[model samples]
Each structure stands twice: as structure tokens, then as C-alpha cells.
Target: MLPNLDDIAPNMAGLTIFSILHAAPGFSQIPTQDESKLRTMFIAPFGRSCYAHVPVGICLGPEYFQTKMTECLKGREGCEAVMITQSSTKRH
Candidate 1:
């Protein structure tokens, strides 16, 4: 069982935020104000990239979510999963 609204914690000051986009069919979830700020951190034209952490609530879930994702990533259906990430760093 996932945590409910009442279980949500306050956004700690200076903490970074990330968004997940798998719940909505065919489209991503709306970005919160924090996400907008993070987007601004990207320097475009020259180059732009996101060194972000995936939202925990969105990533960690019941078996249903993880199972499908794991199978889908391991070449289960002619699909490939590739993530380009660097050494994890503290965000804020």
C-alpha cells in the first residue's frame, strides 16, 4: 500500500525535487514550482542536461509497478532500457 495524502511530508527547505511521469497514460505529470526552478538550472543553447533524482514516491511502490518496470527493462518485449547517470550527488 502506498502512502496517502495525509502521509506526505513537507518539502524541506533547500531540498531538491524531482517528478515522475508514468502514472498518466501517454503524458507526463504536471511539473511543480520546484521542478520549474530546477529546469532553470539547465543552461540551454550551449548545452542542457538534468542531473536529477527520480521522485521516491513515484519510484518506490507496490509490486505492480516495480515488476512491470523490471521486466520491461530486461528485454522482455523488444524494448531497451538505458539510463545515463553519473555518480550520485547530494542535491540542494
Candidate 2:
């Protein structure tokens, strides 16, 4: 299930929280072996093209990004004050 922001709201009571957003986050860094799997064809008058990066509509993009963020936050101090999901990350 998608994470519920309300469930974590109580934990932030009386604490200053900050949220950071990265523009166009988590797509271009795809591994070479996996790029082909994320490709799509264009049926136009000219020719066809494919994506070199993962598209936002790909089924596993969000989950993969979340997993990477989780790994990155592991063992860091005040990590418990942080909440991460496919769309955003909040810190307090």
C-alpha cells in the first residue's frame, strides 16, 4: 500500500520538519542492462526512438526509488525523524 502521511503526522508533533524535493528525480541513472526493458517505440512519420532512462509510468520505478532512498538513510543519525516514499522525503 502507498504510505499514509497521516500515520506519521503524530510523530512530528512539536518538532520542526523539513521536506526537500528534487526536480525530475530518479530516472536517468538506469543500469545499461535494464535500459532496453524500459524502452518504447514511436510510430510516427520519421522513425522510432527509445528511452535511455526509466519512464515515470514504469510499474517498479517508485518502489525502486524508495528502496534506494531507504538504503541511503539506513544508520544515519535522526533517520527515525525522516520519512521517505515514492514521491517525497521529509526530515525533522
lDDT of each: 0.42, 0.57
Worst 10 residues of 1 by lDDT: 23-32
After superposition, candidate 2 runs with Cα above 4 Å error = 1-24, 31-35, 77-92
Provide the global lDDT of candidate 1 against the true structure: 0.42
Per-model TM against the reference = 0.22, 0.43
Clashing pairs in 2: none
Give the Cα error of residue 68 in candidate 1, in Å: 6.2
| Candidate No. with top TM-score | 2
Question: What tens-digit string does per-residue lDDT give for candidate 1 at 25-48?
Answer: 311222334554364355679787
Give each model's clash number.
0, 0
Q: How far is candidate 1 from the true structure (C-alpha RMSD, Å)?
A: 16.4
